[model samples]
Target: MARYVTGAPPPSLDPAVVALLEKAETATIGHWRHWGFVDRRVAPLLPRRRVAGTAFTVMLPANDGTMLAHALDHLRPGDVLVVDRLGDRRHACIGGGLAVAAQAAGAVAAVVDGPCTDLEEIEEAGFPVWCRGLAPVTTQIFDMGGAMNVPVSIGGAVVMPGDAVICDNSGVLVLPPGEAEAEARRAIETQARGAETARRVAAGELRMGVVSGATARVTGG
Candidate 1:
């Protein structure tokens, strides 16, 4: 059996906010739809937590909740465990107990493209988890799943060990290898500008001036 390891630490940032904006909003996801790296269906089950670093993905034959339990034994701090339950909604791949273990093992967060159990427990532990929904049903480990970093699909995105995954209240976003640093800079700036515009609107600024001017520049009008 081979073990997975990150060659180096990821770019430094506040984990909470990093996870918050890492998601490609519906619009951005549409923009990257052709890139084949977006997961459009997963929803956040708990509050946002920063997620960065190489993706450490595990593919389970089904929703065997114990995969995270086993994987935590080797998961290092700052790792993002991406779990695939073969797109099964019959059971949850993660729940409260596993959330605590993953956090204790130093994982940044967990993203399950299937269901999850122990919603209250996960929230109590303060470990961020994003999943499709909640379900108490679970699959036995005997079915299938692997650890120590691997590539797997979530929604429609193919995530590899060590690739960047950004999740927020908006949605989940994957940053391809060698793209995190630059993309993060651009994302942060775009988000900040958006926030500023929102504030101005709250103070009664008209979109005709700010938004229209930007639209015209892009349209070359």
Candidate 2:
């Protein structure tokens, strides 16, 4: 047996705020010591792609996917679906059809705590998905019920609906709505500094360790 929990609609991230986050990489943001990142194993299905949007979280029961379809109705363009599989990594509750539906609904990406099926079709649909791994075993509509738009844990981080979700080849990070704007601004500045350092290095004016201050920190000089 399962239960479906419903509540008021969660807030959405402003498009400008989403754009700010999209400008920075997860690794850069994580460097600031934000711990909302999902596990490294949950990585993008394609290489060199990134996703930044508000989270639309779902909590599914083990081996059942009754609520996923219902969840799609709430998606908006630039929304990232974060699925918590209730620690059942064995079952892949998402597949090609769901991916298509998500894309059609304007979801930018999906992050699943468990495995996923239909990698080929998901890729074909150009829907970016992050998951533990690939599995031929898929879940069914058990009608057992699940939860949506609630706080759920994925990859050790509590992701609530409306939280900012940033994903790339590096990994996924969940930013609380309250912190998203400030953190994005910080990450943008860091990215600019990094770009300058890279340029200096390319011009043979700076060494990697020297530019990063690692040499000075270690040599004590």
Q: What Cα-based lDDT does every candidate model obtain?
A: 0.66, 0.88
Query: Each prediction's TM-score against the native?
Result: 0.75, 0.95
List, residue by residue over 135-207, the lDDT tens digit for candidate 1.
8787665534344465678888887676777766666777675666556666566667777888887788757
Candidate 2, 14-84: lDDT as tens digits: 99998898887889988867689888988877784766998988989878888888888878888898999
Q: List the residue pairs that clash in candidate 1.
A: 15-50, 19-50, 54-162, 55-162, 55-163, 60-145, 61-144, 77-106
Runs of candidate 1 with Cα error greater than 4 angstroms are: 1-38, 63-67, 143-148, 199-206, 213-221
Q: What TM-score does prediction 1 earn?
A: 0.75
RMSD, one per candidate, in order: 5.0, 1.4
* Poorest lDDT segment (10 consecutive residues) of candidate 1: 1-10
Which ranges in model 2 have alpha carbons more than 4 Å from their true place? none
